[model samples]
Target chain A: MVTYPGLPGPIICDYLSREASRGRYGPGVEFQIGKIEMVANTGTYLDSPFHRYAGGKDLSALPLDSLANLDTVVIRIGGGSVRAIPRAAFQDVPVQGRAVLVHTGWDAHWRTERYLSGNPFLTADAAEYLVSQDVRLVGIDSVNIDDIDDPARPVHSTLLGADVPIVEHMCRLNLLPDRDVRFFAVPAKVAGFGTWPVRAFGVVST
Target chain B: MVTYPGLPGPIICDYLSREASRGRYGPGVEFQIGKIEMVANTGTYLDSPFHRYAGGKDLSALPLDSLANLDTVVIRIGGGSVRAIPRAAFQDVPVQGRAVLVHTGWDAHWRTERYLSGNPFLTADAAEYLVSQDVRLVGIDSVNIDDIDDPARPVHSTLLGADVPIVEHMCRLNLLPDRDVRFFAVPAKVAGFGTWPVRAFGVVST
Candidate 1:
């Protein structure tokens, strides 16, 4: 489901096939019921605070205590042509409510076209210093943490205007470590919706 | 995003609006980039085994250790007129490799029409006794594990034909606590998608 170069990708067919559920579960009983349309920013997503506040908090007002398990902190910032990323690169982490994530290895230009143009963002003073250190999530292995020609996204308007929760097209993050990571990105609570697509994972302490 | 009565429900518009991002980020900067179309089994979901063996394994071959933070077990079964269930209601716990939820509190008839007529499931000899006790995942708080008027799903063809993964319409499970539960239902690794929709959570040890 990795398709986001101007969205609209993900149409996985079959709403009951396998020879049509073997004619409604006959033969040695069959099953399959896929169906999807998509464009909540295609892959690896997660963006609550109603995707930039309109009376914030959607995706069913987020809380499973701020997504699955949380309490993570990655930071690294390795990989070429350093683009922006200020606030003294998150001043040696201990980022408040944790789930900092920024390992910029831009997911090795995932699914090409150089991952939608020379990206690597986050710097309205690193989103106002991770929303003045009350972070509960903010991820990015690239592709828009703002600076897609800066349409004044200002790091998604200062970390979704402080209700936090971001997580972009992330990828491994060099196998997470640097703080007892344990994040998890859930979605599909959908109430008046505001950004979907997530299966983000993290959980290390090996 | 709770459709699935003949599918299609989730059209959440807005592909960058907030008065069109304040005419492209002018004013005190605005943002919103939503867009969704539905059907991946609408609301609560998960089921890999290519959704039922075509060559099995889908959702990008599911592993974040069998869908996030395992070791769970609820099995309460206490709703009215208990439908099916069996395998002696999971004969005194210790369900081999965890995640065997089934708290038929039928989610207090979730979004009504009695959550689609007569809803508790999981029989086929309790899905072949949790696929011969190798359960790594299998959830339910209602609305299907099998027995949606027996379309011969055979507990979803005997636990997704032994690749074992299935979570469906789950709700709190009467606030879980019958085992050190810590489940988490993830989805969106979509490869020919077999099912989607999830925000199913669980984690107890208070």
Candidate 2:
């Protein structure tokens, strides 16, 4: 039902399962699904402060309001040649106390080798600007909000250090209006776990 | 920042770890701190069909849409003394194709011994009525939507078997207006896993 124009269908990475050969519950079988088998961060994900800060709240300590019912505003910075979105891009949009979802439309490359290409991203200044605005959540339709190829990764540090949750690998932003939808990207609650996969989405009134 | 109005506060739990003694890379030491242990269903959680159905999509196969961006309407029953919500209670509510959030104010009992006793629940007929309305999601603020003591769990079957996700252990329904908010309850994508905790909340326009 989610149709994207000018893009291939959404790619859902098939979840792989490793048959238990031996484990504690007995030699017979033990299904250690999340912990042992998959990447701690995969699919759509939420990055918490623990991902960047030394003494930050793990997934368990993340406030429920941090991930739920956030007033969302999506900024459309399209036209193929966007390298990094600047603070000026958000000039008239309200950012305080809301989830700022940047619709880059880069998730169209999910799962394919192209997903890792030079996708649109937020500038370091833009991230600092968001934190200055007291944004609760920042989400992107790209591989990562930080330039993945960048060794410094300023976006992750600026945002996560402020305890602002970031959602990456999001699909279907094309279905959303630029400024009216509600965004949610809830991470798992584990004492020491900070970054983990999440099923993030937006709800708009009809 | 999430100050709960009453007793249990918010039963929504969180777990995030970075060092693990056990996992896929195997026992001794692993760099990735996976979620090694937690209640299968904890915090704000979801009850998928596989939680109760023998042949159903496990947590991994469940569609992302089932847990995301649901049009929600909270029906506030049990104003004072009423405990059981019957099918007739929802006759006037617009339930078709929406997430029906039943707020019983029982979230006030979370984490206390009192939470485990005499919880309000929906009747069997209420479950049938919801299915008839083709509801996308069903949620409640209690520990469980049905009387957990009831071995049959008709509400679980009728709703989950229809592939409708059920969110439990929510707090702060008192803060939301009945019909204007959108609810989101999302779970992790772990293949073959039946259930996991969730952070469910509603969005209201300011």
Candidate 3:
């Protein structure tokens, strides 16, 4: 997964005292407590409908069937000169009720200045087509599914408005097969939150 | 799930301009961004080996097999006067290579002050027995798996020292069957972090 640029990854600090704990307990018993500070959108994350619409469903309200144990499809857009993924790219795939992942191979530039500029993105037409096909979820291996330079954010607006969740900043899409895999990208069930980081992975049946 | 007392729940704040986005794009194009700040131990959370040992495996280091799609066993301990769960509580069940969940029915007091105090926890002997049995993971429907008053945190020390992950503050354990269930408690893959909140749930075959 591509680490979010400028976002503090994770801060681990001591919470309880090991010496004090050991002294209070036995010699072999030494416990340490830690505290972490992180932003909701720090790394590879999912954006629920509430991320785009104020009254839309938040992370807590999402159904588990939509996020976990999903049939998945991987669309490789790497080695292509076109940056904007168009509707034709998805016309041939069976996207209904599956996690459609667009692998742009842009994760190679993760954590670098190159990752921030000229990243691949899905066009508004592609987002509309995915919505029409009734995809369960959409994911991309890029900084954002929409062009960051475009303040309109048409891709996010089209997909999230239809209650289709989006996973961004994913890596290792190349590791997954082109079709027939189980996908999961569940986030912490935090109420009132629209977006948060997740442990996104695909499970292939051996 | 029991919400940790005094811990801040998710807060969703607006990030981008809805009016500007709509004006820039089409009429229905309005985007809303959110910011969230939460304590890692706020709700039902998983503790990696690093939670107790600084040099041990962090969240990112944990294997997927250890966290997802494991056969689970639920042991109900409600309506009993006992607070300290002993090793004998697990004597009758098949716990080896499974996710053992102790359902204390303490989730009834979730989000209440009663949930914080007088919660059920595992004894040190119980943790040792689970380790000996080679259980994949342990979960409980209580404020914590260890007695919070005991600064020693014997349960955490014993379990985490054995590299067995623990999921605390789980709820709805009663919903799961006594056997033949799939358990998942995946946390965000944040490096250098020992503990973080998770979307803990079980998949029961229909």
Model 2 alpha-carbon drift over 4 Å, by segment = A1-40, A57-109, A112-123, A129-136, A149-151, A177-180, A188-192, A204-206, B1-40, B54-85, B88-98, B113-119, B177-179, B189-193
> What DockQ number belongs to candidate 2?
0.14
Q: Could you list the CA RMSD of all candidates, in the order they appear?
A: 16.9, 9.2, 2.9
True contacts kept of each: 0.80, 0.19, 0.55
The model with the greater DockQ, 1 or 2, is: 1
What's the TM for model 2?
0.67
Superposed model 3: Cα runs more than 4 Å off: A1-31, B1-30
Per-residue lDDT tens digits for candidate 2, residues A116-172, read: 768788889999999999999898888768775664667877888899988887878
Chain B TM-scores, listed for every candidate in order, come to 0.34, 0.81, 0.91
Top model number, DockQ: 3
Per-candidate local distance difference test: 0.79, 0.69, 0.82
lDDT of 1 by residue, A75-94 (tens): 88765579888888888778
DockQ of each: 0.32, 0.14, 0.49
Per-residue lDDT tens digits for candidate 3, residues A1-206, read 32554445544455555565466565576655555545556688999988788789999999988899889999989593558999998999888868899998998888888888787999999999999899999999999899877767889888888889999999989999999798999998777778888889987888
Clashing pairs in 1: none
Order of quality (lDDT): 3, 1, 2
